[model samples]
Target: MKACIITIGNEILKGRTVNTNAAHIGKFLTSRGYEVERGITVKDNLDEIKWAIDESFGKYDIIVTSGGLGPTFDDMTVEGVSRALGLELVEDRETLEILSKRYKELSAELTPERLKLAYIPAGSHAIRNPVGAAPGIWISGGKSSILVLPGVPREMEAILDQADSLINKNDRFYYEATERLAGVMESAMAPIVNRIMEEHAGEVYVKTHPLKSETRNPEIDVEVSAYADSAEMAEQAVRDTIREILAEARRMGKK
Candidate 1:
């Protein structure tokens, strides 16, 4: 399965807050064998969020969006999702009731701001957030699915952990992993890695990201992934493949 993560918040873009939401979730999805196509952070502008959601459908099968689910006026993910799916924004009764209960639990009165958490797009399933007031929205498009999550890192993580069943039910994808290889040169390793990949083309990905340095020293980081039915199998494949590359490099050094 291919997925994209969109982290919504002007604060993230302005560097007021660290945008760890996308990066964290991307790693989560990647570790589950899903291919993460792109991870981006956009401002709270509904149009931009809508556009990103709409565009992600064309490029990825699943889109996981974070941020913009709160009682604040700036929380616009629900409306943005509505526009993306061509639906009307309406208060979901069940979600509203949940929010009301949360307020009561806190011995606080429900205000208009708190009620804002109840707005959900029509025809979308509400992802209940037991730990937070804002309920997330889940929608299915033609061939894509979108999940809107909270901006708070802890809340989003809580929902993700408790909602593993929902994620697993979405699609069937195999194993993939990425490791940082910061001490190698891509030019010196490309031919050998390519040869290994040619032997296992259908199930493995050998990606190298070269870190650009103004310093005289440079480093290339390599990430290896193997696709299989189980994590153990995939992990083993990656280890064995990496071992072969390392062994070959060692032998070459001796020659």
Candidate 2:
């Protein structure tokens, strides 16, 4: 399965806010066996968000978007998604009730701005946000699923935790193992990684990351990962690849 992450915020484009949501969503999906194929940053413009959604729907199995889900005027993620999917924006009564009760508890009036959070695309499920008021949106189409989350890192993570069943719809298993090598240059590890990848072919993938300057005390971290139909299979594939990598490093006279 493949996933695409769309971060909608002008703040992100202006470099005012780091897009930690995309990183978190990417890692979350990858651990569940979905390949994160793309990460897109779009301004709060409706057209850009719609375009990102349209482009990702058919190409990716899962589309996770963050930002613009608040009650403020700039929060238009729901509307953009509605337009892109051609779904009518309808008010979810349960969500409205929840919001109303929440505001009443705070001794605050439910203004139009606060009421706006209750509207979502027709036929979409609202995933409760554990840390915020705006509920996350979940839409399941033929082969794709869209998960709209709040931009706030804490709220996004909390909503995702509640959305485990929706996100883990597939049975594929993914496993990764990493080994740190001291005094081994990434330059030398590159060929070894390539060879291991070729030898394992579709079963495993190997990559090397240099931790220190190659000219000085060269240290590299080699990561081997695999995806399979079962957990045992994926784990065994990564284990085998890691063993091969260590053997190759020893042959090259690197500890």
Residue range with the least summed lDDT across 10 consecutive positions in model 2? 191-200
Residue ranges of candidate 1 with Cα displaced over 4 Å: 105-108, 170-184, 209-221
Most lDDT-accurate candidate: 2
**Clashing residue pairs in candidate 2 (N, C-alpha, C atoms within 3 angstroms):** none
Please write out the lDDT profile of model 1 over residues 1-255, one tens digit for every residue.
888999999999999998888888887887666788888788999899988977777678778999998877888888887888888978899988887877898899889888888888777778778777777777766668787889999889877766566566433445544544444566766898788889989777787777755233546666777767776778788888777766876665621
58: Cα error in model 1, Å: 4.3
Model 2 C-alpha lDDT per residue in residues 133-196, reported as the tens digit of each score:
9999999876678999999999999999888888896699899989999989999788878877
- What lDDT would candidate 2 get against the real structure? 0.91
TM agreement with the true structure for every prediction: 0.84, 0.96
CA lDDT, candidate 1, residue 124:
78
